[model samples]
Target: MHQTRLRITRILCMIMITALMVPLFSGCASKGNSDADKGQTAQPDTQQQEEKVEEKDPVTLKFPIWSTITEDLFTKLDLVNEYKKDHPNVTIELELLKDTEYENTLKIRNAANELPDIMPLKSAWLVNFKDNILPLDDLEAAKNNLFAADFKVNDQILGVPESQFNEFIWYHKSVFQEYGIEIPKTWEEFVNAAKKIKDGGKYIPIAMGGKDAWPDYPFNEFMPSLVAGDGDYWSAMATKDEPFAKGQPFYDAYVKIKELYDAKVMGPDPLGVGFDQSKLMFGSKQAAMIALGQWFGSDLKSMTDVDINDIGAFLLPVRDSADEPFNTVSMVDTFYTIPKTSKHPDEAKEFLNWFFSNAWYPKYMSEAGLQSTIKDVKIDLGTMFNGAFDVSNLKYVLNKGGNEDYKKIESTIKFDVKKMGQDMMAGKDFDKMMQDMNNSWKNARSKLK
Candidate 1:
């Protein structure tokens, strides 16, 4: 009976040991499962961290524009607001200035070292401000859409042009019809047409805003381009010692303009009015023609009681024969640039890329009524351009590239051709004016050498 009791005790001890061991095994299995779960969850957590890192930090960019950002163009397009949808982090601060005051303001800001991040620059001003502007040749936007005149500065690209403008004579079709003036094909014919309208005494032949110096540019700045039929006329003139002589392109063109003035073709006291007054005179049918570029189309379209269909444009006739091809001055009007002093150059570049892309470029061109500088983008400026758009009938005279020697001489001499046009209208002696210009130009060139 005692032996049987000892065997029972040993069995009981084995059962006790097995019961304690079960809890230890359960604890180990739970730990192994927990580690496996963590291994599976770690990859997704790492991916989430990477996604957070990819998010862009918020940024603001300053965009300085002249006359383009107001209630008319930029506001109508809602470009900035639309851009924000995709790049929610970027905010564009637009600084608008009147076209007349823009260049001076920009110069002031540049001197103060406070240029905006994005600047709309005229092509002629690029060479002057290149030191402060950043080179954009390597940017994808520059590479993709830049034209011959765009971004070129001392072999480095400093900006990209958005659109180009061609100089022309905008006319009222009804006035031309009433006067029996067919579109003039030659300079002489153009004069005759003007004379006919002027002799009528009821309307001004050619409405001129000579008070505003820039309104005279089509005749002063672009006439030589037509007379020479060469894109490099201005630069080539710089090489000549007597570029203002009788047979020279500059002299010949000015002589033609003087003849027009002598004929009393421009309205009485042409210099007495400004651009707005001239536009009104033409819009009211009191004037038959006005010399301007494609930009004037929008203004004409906006006039009260003015029919858009009644407005027409033709390339300024410089050639002698209807059979001969005429040359037109086509130039890059405005360019986009990033100033070296910008705090957000990368963001500026991003904005430019977005601007020139296929998505937004067409819409911008349509609203601005400008021809595209980008390759393969076609813009129809409608009837306002008229014969100006026909490539077969015309050759293009692009703005001449800058020369250091010419730039120096131009600055020192300060020969104002626009002022010369006003003087001609005011009955100044053409011969004396030409003589003075020749003397001044020679002296300036001699100083440069």
Candidate 2:
């Protein structure tokens, strides 16, 4: 009987052990499966992110410029090869166009919705092209550009200027000394000095390239801005029905310009000579002076025949009195812009940022002999500009673009101040032209959309 009872106890112990072992094995199996499932589910997500990061599409950017290779500093910098070194998948193709046809060509392309990925804009065209351009306000390039914000349209920066320059009356120092004339400080003095040089009959007093019309910018396009002491002169003029009437600022400026043209101090047949001829004449010492912008300094440097050491520059005096504020044209030019129609907007922005980077901007500024428009960059004007800017009442008249309404009025009237300059040189009746402009301006103002 004792042996049989011991066997039953052993059996009961075996049963309890089996039951505990079953549950423990089942728990281990469940935990293993759970971990395997979690890893299997998360692996694809990690791979997907890695794949997304590796995907890049090849891109090509169409960049058109009006400046030829000789005039464009980027060409000398090997811009394409340098850019290609880091971006093998990207290409920049620049097309050269005639400078005279550049604006009209762009207008045509814009109408066809085929504008290039990148282009340069003048301050005056910013308003006309604002709608088609993508505002660069968010770009680092725009943020770094000192003049970009100053030319914003509707609070959006459409483009950023690469350089800043002042208009100058480039002269031959020897000629001035020979004629016993000093750098003019007022409008009267300027005309008188030119008259004196003409009276000597040794050389042309001033080089007037009236044929191209654009070469007349210093007097016709800019004098009114200098008179107003800002770039808002044209926009302000658009507001009135007769902005060119007698006693008006536009009238006052044009009258002064007319007086200069009438002096016949720019040579016997100023209208017949084109800009290239005028520039050559000035370079060869046949002309004493030429009214051009600071960019001309670089052009002057390119002339191998001329003795550039004799060249001097000064701000064009448009003020009536030496006591008045000495207003001068401070132009921010070569406004690089990206079109809204660009195929590769992000890539174009990247290129622009890189263009303005420390790698390229400083070198370009030095090579082009242009003042830096970027923050944290400086350019020395060198000896040619020594004492040229010495004035107690000097004020910079920044060339901010006109407002939309102004552009509309301008387009309607077909008003071209530079062309007006050509007409003045051609001996057109000045008052009659101003009156016609007033009539056209009034008629245009009444038709705005």
Indicate which candidate wins on TM-score.
1
Q: Write the per-residue lDDT of candidate 2 for residues 1-449, one digit (tens) a residue.
A: 89999999899999999998999999999999999999998999899986765565678899888876334666778888789887777888988889899889999999999999887888888887888999999999999899899888888999989899999999999999998888899999999999999889999999988878899989999888887776788789877899899988888898999999999999888888999999999999999999998888878877887888899999999888999999988889989999999999999999999999997888877777778999989987777888899976999988766788888887877888899999999989988999899889999998873
Candidate 2 residue 171 Cα shift, in angstroms, is: 0.5
User: Model 2 clash pairs?
Assistant: none
Query: Number of clashes in every candidate structure?
Result: 0, 0
Model 1, position 249, has a per-residue lDDT of 90
RMSD of 1: 5.2
- Clash-forming residue pairs, model 1: none
TM-score of each: 0.86, 0.86
Error of 2 at 296 (Å): 0.9
**Minimal lDDT window, size 10, model 1:** 384-393
Cα lDDT of model 2 overall? 0.88
- Scored against the true structure, residue 204 in model 2 reaches a CA lDDT of 96
Error of 1 at 448 (Å): 1.5
